[model samples]
Target chain A: MSLDKADVVKIAHLARIAIDEEMIPEYTNNLSGILELVEQMNAVDTDAVAPMAHPLDMVQRLREDQVSEENQRDKFQEISPKVENGLFLVPQVIE
Target chain B: MEWETVIGLEIHAQLATKSKIFSGASTAYGAEPNTQACAVDLGLPGVLPVLNKEAVAMAVKFGVAIDAEIGKRSVFARKNYFYPDLPKGYQISQFELPIVGLGHLDIELEDGSTKTVGVTRAHLEEDAGKSLHGEFQGMTGIDLNRAGTPLLEIVSEPDMRSAKEAVAYMRKIHSIVTYLGICDGNMQEGSFRCDANVSIRPKGQEEYGTRAELKNINSFRFVEKAINIEVERQIDVLESGGKVVQETRLYDADKDETRSMRSKEEANDYRYFPDPDLLPVEIEDGFIEAARAALPELPDQKKQRYIADFGLPSYDAGVLTADRETALFFEQVVEKSGADAKLCANWVQGELSAALNKDGLEIAQSPVNAEMMSGMMQRMADNTISGKIAKQVFQAMWAGEGDADAVIEAKGLKQITDSGAIETIIDDILANNAAQVEQYRGGNEKVFGFFVGQVMKASQGKANPQQVNELLKSKLQA
Candidate 1:
């Protein structure tokens, strides 16, 4: 139920977060404590109950399939860092 | 060692919806870049995703078409990954609880046998945008217009034993989805795409070999070729004292080879968790029933009906029903022409298919519409034009000449059905081919075909073939 230093490092890497090597212990402790709380919550047997997905007892609101949005490309791209030929450009991510 | 190939397909069928899956932005393809991307699709802060009712209904219809168990309490989860195409760091997808489950599709095999492929699940997810790699200098151009498009990712079990079986399975899925009107099933525009997991095991081995997930295979031919090449590569690796590495590979159809997608190797973990922004979608029985009621007759059902009702051969039924549009065109021809269904099936599968393929047009985009096709079929059915001459009339119709009657009149290609005119042509053919007549009377019955051919030729291929046969037989005997 607890995360080790390597686990925290891998988690940080997967999350694309930059964490200092010296701060790994502190982050691991914090993350492990959160996991322990989850463990304590998981200890109670609730097999008969359905898994809750949201805090509020409500289903997802459904929207009708209609095109309500207009052409806001110029307005939206005005805030982007880089754009060319009506495209958002980023570092090469060829895969 | 006899190696047996195992293939399982993961098909991503873009649902035919007007708007995005979770946003109101338009999902139309080929729009101006980023024009259809709204704040929600752009993943702006504080923007929540609302489920599209049509998307859910489409998914439900797909499930019902496949006889799948619709997930009443389906939940969306976050598939965490990092890519520029995915504006959000994580994709909202259904993980532990998918929308559809445990369906099966029976694919017709090469030998006229059927194999039921097990569909593991079909989950709804949003597609990532296109990453134009070489367009920008040291950067990728991203079009977020496709970022939030809804996709039904259908996963199949490793039930296919060959590349042909895999293609058959993909085609069956494509047919069913298009028939349900859930997906357009256009592989070229990437409305329908497939990723195959291919591996090989010994013939008698119960355990499977390590599989390589082949990505970027768009067309059915590429799917089959990719699986076959990947299987060969795996077998090569095994026989050369090396083990096959289980990884995602890219199928370069242009090169006809698969290469390792090394960039994705390190970051393969898609840490999935329940997405809290969206709540559980509780599909009730009433909703499922409505979707089921809205379901069109599926491809398999139509194929079976074509066989049972029309007495079409299994192959013809399969070909005619493989595409919903083609099947609709065939049925319309049958109804309009009042001809035999088998005859309509033949024209649809033979000449119509050839013309459509030659022009690289879909049945919907055919130059000759159903009415025109049925008109020609009616001519052939009512003996107004010989079948051979019908082909000529069809070419004329395809060339924008006119309807069957107009083309027949313009070309003077009406069948020589009048007894007097046909007998004149037959008498001339019989007189000119005195040698052939003697040969036929001398019991060399094969020359009867030559006599019939000569008669038809004299009639400019307009002689009714049955009448030609009868008159020629009686004349030669006398």
Candidate 2:
């Protein structure tokens, strides 16, 4: 349950957040602590116990096949602050 | 120099549930920035979250579709994080016990090789709101309409060895989501997103090399590109005797390069424990059976049936079965028009696909449907409309729906198949192209094309080419 300090630095760089050297030790400690808990989970002997995956076991839910929806144009565009008429307004994209 | 690329994918698909995964607010897209959000989504004091039933159903639906085990009991865990977009300061997700277990899906490689990709597991989680960067002074604007929306994190096994296989697997996943009606399957809409884990090792190496995970690759093409570039980068690093570091990266589509976003960290420290608020979700066998029964025909099975039943080629079956709507449309066209299934596949792939892209419309919005297309194709087969005039009729059919007969009648686009009309046109073409006609008589029979061209021009391209060619040959010989 230990992550190297350098691994913490690499993770921060990959996540694109600038973290100073001071935060690296803290992150490393925290990450290792979490992995410790995860390793504890592995100790439980339950090879016979099936892995529970999804919560729902229903076979199927069928909806009456019908084409019944309108293309909500005005309603969809109403939320955008940058709307020109019916289209989402974006900054001038072309010269 | 023999090496192989190993690729796996982590896909986070926004579920089709009406409400947010844990909140009562509507989980709709394209909504007003902060309006649809409830107090819980806003993270107000003491607002607890309740999981949406639809989301559970959707998760079960996917499990059933893939023939994966439905966890009769599952629990949601809290993933602690601090970000401006995550108002709750933690997302509710499944970590220890996922909702769906391991399953295998088969995909066909481009070179006609088949391989089965392994699905690691699928877990359900709630989404965080978006942070709008680059809006003003680099200050982020938070949009909560998407907050608390349900997402299923599907992790795949590192079974793919090439960029093409990776994409094919992703496409298969996309088809499953769409076919299950569990997601809109819109990659551009941020509804379905992919994070690829890529590594490269020597051709015969058993132990895998350190893998780099790339995030925010939204499109399938970008996923393939990112994987290929990452593969090359890893190869270069190993060749130079430098160790590859495990980190998260972003694919800059403009630069066509991947840059390290951060080092990969095991987030287990989020103190992931089952949320105390929600009880362990218990799914009975009856519930699982119902979800299983609702599974639609998956893409691979549908593709195989199109081959065995419809006599479509493997490639044709692949293209048609890429999407559920496209497959259904092709089948309906084949049924209603009673046209050859092969022709139906061709017309749908050729003309229907072109029109759908040009107009930026979904298959549901197309003016010409499967039946109308089949009708038009059948008419062409019967010589009621030459293939040339069929285009004109097709253009009309796209703008407005009328069968081949009505569209042809309104647009006056019937094929000139009558022998009398064709003969007259052929005679005129022979008179007009006397030089070419004389050449044909003088043993330059290859010049016969000159008469066919003139006949087409005289008949305004409505002349049946086969009929015109035969009539012209006889008249010229006589």
Candidate 3:
């Protein structure tokens, strides 16, 4: 359940976070501590208990299926870093 | 050593609702980029998602149509991932408990046999926006119009042993969804699409081999080809003493090959947890009853009814009921023309289908509709036109000439049922073709066809064939 320095680096890369070499030990210890907590939680015997997806027992609110929104492309794209031809532009993504 | 191919399909069928699943933004296709994306769909901070009632009803309809167990309560979860198209950094989907569970679809195979494919589950989810790559130089354009659209992701068990079975299963789902009017079932527009998980193992092996998922294949043909190619690739890798690597592959239809898109090492964790903003969906007995009552006659029931009532062969019934429009058109033709059920089936599946295919039109888009077909069949039944001439009339009708009677009259293509007119044509043929007549008299029974052909040709192909034979026989004997 413990994360080492290499594991921290890989996790950071997957999360797209930039971390300095000095911060790897700190991240490893913090992540491993969380994992150890999860391990301790998993050790409890609860064979008869039903798994719950949410803590609240409330039901979902249903909405009417109608087109109630107006076109706000110009206004929404105004906050983007880049936009062209009514599209939000981002740096090139390689397939 | 034989290899057994295993396949499972995950189909995404977009619900035919007016608005997005979580927002009131328009779900209409081909809207201006980002126009239909409201604040909720754009994933603004503090915005909550409200489930659309119509979308839930459509999902329930599918579950009922497939005879699946409807989950009384299902929870929505956030599938965390990072992509340019995913503005929210996650997708709202059902994880552990889907709405529909443990159903089986009975598919009629090409060999006139039926096989049941197991459906693991069908869950409701929101689609991501499209990233328009390669169009903008050094940048990608994102269109969020498709984001938040409702999709029912139907997952199947790995019960398919061949590509054909997979295709049949996919097509059966397509027909059911379209028949229910829940999905438009347009694969080219991506309203309906599938991802195939394929693997191969030694024959009779209990354990499954590593599976490679082929993603986002739109057409049934592509689904079949992609699975076959992937199966072959897996078999090759296994035979070469190399273990198959589990990965996600993309089917390049143009090149007819599947290449690795991403391997397991690079795959996303997709940490899924229940969304706190949206509550668990609770399906009451009233809603389930309403959905059941609203279910139309599905394809299987329609096929069985066609077989039982119309006395059609299983194959004919299957073909007619494969599509709702075709089955309705067949029924209308039979009801209007009062033709025999077998005859109606033949004309619809044989002649009408051929004509539709020739023009690249669906039955709904047919220039010669069911009424026109009934008229043509009625003409044939009443001896107004022979079977041969009816085809000509059909062509004329399709060419926008007129109805069956009008075409037959305008072209003088009516059958000449008068015995006297046929006798005259036969006598004229007998006189002109003396050598063939003598050959017939010399006990050459096969030469009779030549006389029939000549008489019909002299009569401008209007000579009633039976009458031509009868009259020509009496005269030659005399």
Clashes of each: 0, 34, 0
Order of models, best DockQ first: 3, 1, 2
Worst 10 residues of 3 chain B by lDDT: B262-271
User: How close to the true structure is residue B244 of candidate 3, measured as C-alpha lDDT?
Assistant: 87
lDDT string for model 1 (B1-478, tens) is 8999989999999999999999999998898899899999999999999999999999889888888999998999999888888898889999999999889889888998898999999999999888899977899999999998999999999999999999999999899888888899988899999999999998989998899999988998999899989988999999999999888899998899999987632767898888989999889999999888877788888888989999999899899989899998988998899998887887788887898889899889887899998999888888999778888988888889989999999899988888888888888888888888888888899998888878887888988999988988888899
Q: Quote the TM-score that chain A achieves in each candidate.
A: 0.90, 0.52, 0.89
Candidate 1, residue A22: how far the Cα is off, in Å = 3.3
- Alpha-carbon deviation at B1 in model 1, angstroms: 1.5
- After superposing candidate 1 on the true structure, give the runs of residues whose Cα lies further than 4 Å from its correct spot: A1-5, A39-44
Candidate 2: docking tier = incorrect
Q: Which regions of candidate 3 fall more than 4 Å away from where they truly are?
A: B263-265
Q: Write the per-residue lDDT of candidate 2 for residues B1-478, one digit (tens) a residue.
A: 7888999999999998777777656666797676666667767678776667778889999988877888877778888766666766678889777889888788998789789888989999988876665553424466667778889999999999999998998899999999989999888789999999999888999999899999898999999999999988888898998999988888999999999875224443475766766667767898889888877888988999999999899999999998999999988888888878887788889888999999898898888977788889889878888777888888888878477889888777778879999998777777777788778889997887767777898888888888887888789999
Candidate 1 C-alpha error for residue B104, in Å: 1.8
The candidates' DockQ values read 0.83, 0.06, 0.84
